[model samples]
Target: MIDPAYVSAMARYNAWQNENLYGAAASLSDEARRQDRGAFFGSIHGTFCHLLWADRMWLSRFTGTPKPSVPGSESSRMIEAWEELAAERQVTDVLIGDWAAGLSPEWLAEDLTWVSGISRRELTKPKAQLVMHFFNHQTHHRGQAHAMLTAAGVKPGDTDLMLVDLRG
Candidate 1:
């Protein structure tokens, strides 16, 4: 089980890593970003889109916010336009930080129950564990995006959590 400070730190870390990943992704042409690179999500743009969609989905379950319109099946194609996707991502990052900041120990200790869109099954689990998975899922996909960006000749810079300038 995790605590509020840990959640806040991870939230900040998520935003910092997102800034780096999106900055590098922004440098690439739309065609390059959308190009099939044999990743789990097909391309850099696709991976980013899927990550955003999943983030929103988890956030919705955790915070009672609105979920993404499309299901996980179409997550890779969530937002078609680069501008819209980027804008939504920036907004979601802030929302995530705010949500993490507001979390209470009592809330984290409770269990969350929701139906899985992908598996079509009702599931219940500890909120603390689910929150960890939320951040973990972002890292899992962002790593794919980072690799794609690098292969396309762009660097996302430092990814280590220790190097994430929390003062920002």
Candidate 2:
């Protein structure tokens, strides 16, 4: 059983982690951030792009926001410029905050059925399951990006859920 507070807290943590991730990225050279680190997405920028893509996909299902122009596209957008990507990521963080705040406990137990752009098939699952997967998916890939960033000498800030500001 997932509490609504837990969802909100996790959303805050996600936003906080992303802020730190992009902030650390700011310290790295353009070539370094783009270097291949063998991550599933290849580079920090690439993983970050895919992470945002996944976030947008889930957010669309969760809140009915506009989907991307390309569905299920995983190739990292050529955000060759770092500052733009970071700024947009911050906006995404705030959007995530509002999205999480709107969710109720009952909504999590309902089901979501949507056309799978990746598989091109109709898929259905409990909203709780999908939401859990959404956050978990972010954490998992972000961990990969974090490891790659650390290897490249960029240290993201604290990741503990306890450190996230509840009022954020």
Candidate 3:
């Protein structure tokens, strides 16, 4: 059985991280959010949007939902309007935590396959690894987003997991 507490903790972590990210993003001028920062996505807003795209893509494969048509590259992601994408990303992260809580060992053990959005060919992998990838991928891209936000002159509050106030 998937422990509900682990899921709840992850959910809170995801929320806390994004709250800091967006809070920092908000301090920047639109021009700053859009500035090139040498990240894979090259800007705070672009990295944020790409993280959302990756989360949705992995969730689709995990839950059999339809994968979105958004291209997961840095350029296509930056073309989106920032505020709307940030809000949508929040919703998707909550859904992922909920899905993770209900997952069974069997579900995680099963292999998932989907046509690669990049290559248009079938790819399959164990679901446990993919689910882990989903969360890890979020952290990876969010770190890039965080760094870019700093370059844009916005301070994202503490990212330390130990600092999360679980009782709050």
Tens digit of per-residue lDDT, candidate 2, span 33-136: 88999998889988888788788778888899876555455447635467877876787778888988888988988899999877889999998888788889
Order of quality (TM-score): 1, 2, 3
Query: Candidate 3 on 80-109: residue-level lDDT in tens?
Result: 777787778778867876776677767766
True-structure RMSD for candidate 1 = 1.1
TM-score, every prediction? 0.97, 0.91, 0.85
Clashing pairs in 3: none
Relative to the true structure, candidate 2 reaches a TM of 0.91
Clashing pairs in 2: none
Per TM-score, the best of the predicted structures is 1
Question: Over the full model, what C-alpha lDDT does candidate 1 score relative to the true structure?
Answer: 0.92
Model 1, residue pairs in steric clash: none
The regions of model 3 sitting more than 4 angstroms off are 1-8, 74-79, 165-168
Off by over 4 Å in 1: none
